[model samples]
Target: MSQSNALIIPGLKVALVPCPALGDTTLLLRLAWRLQAAGACVTVASVSLASVRSYLPGLNIVGGAPDVVALAASNDLVICAIDWQVTVPLSNVAYLAGKKLPRGFNPEQPPVLLAGRVIAGAHNVICRDPKAGKTMVQWIDLYAEEVLGLDTSLPVTGLQDLPAVAEDADRRVAIFPTTPHASKNFSSSGFRRLARCLTARGWLVEFVGIPAEQQKLKAEYPGCTVRTFTDLKGLVDFLSNCAVVISNDSGGGHLGSLLGLRTFTITRRRGDFTWRPGFNELNRVINPILSFKWMGRTVWRPFIPLRRIVRALADVKVQ
Candidate 1:
């Protein structure tokens, strides 16, 4: 289609369906920001309310197939995150019937012949992150730029923007203690040790996590301040106020990096280094030793001492 034709479509809408998790939802929100910049009205559709809240502000939200179809009809383009496999058939039908541009992977890239009138495998249009081979963030940025014709460099809105820092706080430290999988979680024992160390140094530590997880941690660390919020807004609010963030390989680390907070990420292995966040000064990734066999080959690992983590945090230059 011609660029003008694509740009002028009335009610241009893009749907972002995210995995029912805070991290994935955050990635989708970034994509929404890009889409909005590109001139497309973006709606983040998900069955999970938590996921929707985690999305960046200013994007539309839809909960079911019926609404998704109705929304797609009026908009010229519909970009669905691959996580919405349950409602793919309905979405495909809507795109075919409405002649809307459909973007995103479907059933592992189905054959064009069997995929029917819908745009099969348009999901690949959004490039995956080279590190982890996941398209979550890259795709969001791509959809916004390529499909929406929006400028990617415009200051990212929503959670990426931080509140002004408090002048009186002795020190601001962001604590991220959650990970999607056990393997990536920084040891709670190690975290408690670090927390105690920071507290002893008179730094104000802010523990950030999903609401439920934060509540649990608050109960555990009665004296510490823990902000358990599911959405990016609350998370950013806390991160913005912090001078440094110590995180595992989770959404918190990503947010810290994006918001210009100095982020120190603890990883279990180098392979987990994918998506460590760009801009070297704002983000530092520290990998601990772990042995694992890859493709039937044994690999030895080297450990990263706790002293190293502390030193890295000390060296961070807060902007």
Candidate 2:
């Protein structure tokens, strides 16, 4: 028989089921750390645990419905970071109870949110940092305060101290040139030009992509260096060491925000500006529309001029 909570004694057992996005997993890592500090044994239920396991280490990683349900039933606290675009067991409270629980959630704080809402609303449903204001990256502290009941003042240093990064203003430039969706990959030619543009100016440029894309990038641009990463930690370590990051509003971009890199996300969606108001001063985002008046007419153009991005980052210290 599996060990029961009785054997584990008073240590709190918590399960966090996050949206199956790398960005969400990175954010959930923040939440997981808080729970662990509060004496909770945290389990992450996910299909996307390979990268997470590599970064976090020793986490109780699990997937599939039966395993997730059993883990949730056994745990003292169960939380699911709901991404409405996807389906998971925590979609509704009934999915947890296998039947509906009492539906008397306070209307003011509607249960539609991930931490507090109408469906799979667990002990708490944390909505995307409320309209009341908080940077997207900064809200993790708020969640720690309000949800995990941890002291709000303590700094969130990592398990082991990260090695000191280079202090040079002319350090490497990290670029993630691909997005999961093709349409969102700002411009391939533009990214290459930017990398070459920066590389020629005495800055080492690092490009990241899938194996195939990396191969293509190397074949196309034989002179530049392109590194492919399979784990999130490697990605983080690389980005952490870089002066700045440029990406197409993908998970890597979000991770950059978490690490407080001067990340500039070039996007196709106009709504992303207001929707993903990032967590800090370093996490600035922009699109061509903000720079070019003709952008609204050619918004659907495959290529956005690199000059627009250059102008936007004019004030950024691109060492």
Candidate 3:
């Protein structure tokens, strides 16, 4: 392990640089909490820090990329969760923050990690770039167990639901169809059919997302309720009361998982087999397409079979 990876005590500051994804933020937040419990002050550096800043307290939140050396020099340690952030041009974080980066920090070698429990463990050597085939959370879990000496079995990363109110007293099934990327979403038609089917089965279905999306979904099924939230708090409260949540492989799904709701996430990423299969069984990630190269694209068209999704979801007895 490189010297920079060593955890110094009395002033250990861990900067968890995460990808802009909600899953990345959600899982890394657990690591941040664990580090905090272990007495190290942790900060989460992300472009979307504002969205998550409320969930994290006592820890610093940095926006955009800062000089790793300057970041590390100020704190006792810095943990890079996003793999590319550690490479050159991102400020050569491989070099222990004070001096030049050593060879063990090289990309080809196993992660040069800090041993002992002085601070949290980061996958500096064995970092998973692209984070394609595995649950990103599991990778962080490994770091927590091997480097931080913390118990990985406990669930530490869950986001809380706001205080109960009369509006949220009647919980219903939520369907979040809109995603930032079109490729990650199911056809509106699929959701329409699923919503009708669920409501037919006596489930109170509610659709949440942008105003336009809510309008569109409502048009498809007049029986189901369609709602939109203006802020994160509204979204959290609505999701917190949901008996079951079916969402795209986007922030909504991550939020549902963070709320510990029974969620079924539709995804196209093939790496799920490595992490989500047996361990993360509650957060069911349904992806029909494993891998395909078509027309110069690594992952070809993603078409989630809605009937199978309904069947899988039917197995879950929602509370």
Model 2, position 197: C-alpha lDDT score? 69
True-structure lDDT of candidate 2: 0.58
Clash count, predicted structure 1: 4
Error of 3 at 285 (Å): 3.6
Q: Which ten residues in a row have the lowest lDDT in candidate 3?
A: 91-100
User: TM-score rank, highest first?
Assistant: 1, 3, 2
Off by over 4 Å in 1: 5-11, 46-58, 61-67, 87-121, 125-155, 158-164, 168-170, 210-223, 230-233, 278-281, 289-302, 316-319
Please tell me which predicted candidate would have the highest TM-score against the true structure. Answer: 1
lDDT of 2 by residue, 1-319 (tens): 1223121222667777766677666666666666665556778777655444545654677754325556546775566553321234333222221112227623233232222333222334344524544444456555566544455464543334444676763467778878777767766677878877666656677887766678887876667788877755566667778767788878777776666666777776553443242534766555654433374543443445566555555555554
Prediction 1 global C-alpha lDDT: 0.57
- At residue 22, give the lDDT of candidate 3: 56
lDDT of 2 at 53: 59
lDDT for position 137 in model 1: 52
lDDT of 2 at 196: 71
Which lDDT tens digits does candidate 3 get at residues 1-319? Answer: 3334434333566666665555556666667777766557777776655554665566677877655656655654566544434343332132211112344555424343333332322334333443446555565566666765555555453453354644433347788887778877777777888888876665678888876576666776677678887655677767767767788776776667666667777667653533332223467766765567779865633456557656766675644
Cα lDDT computed for each candidate against the true fold: 0.57, 0.58, 0.59
226: Cα error in model 2, Å: 1.6
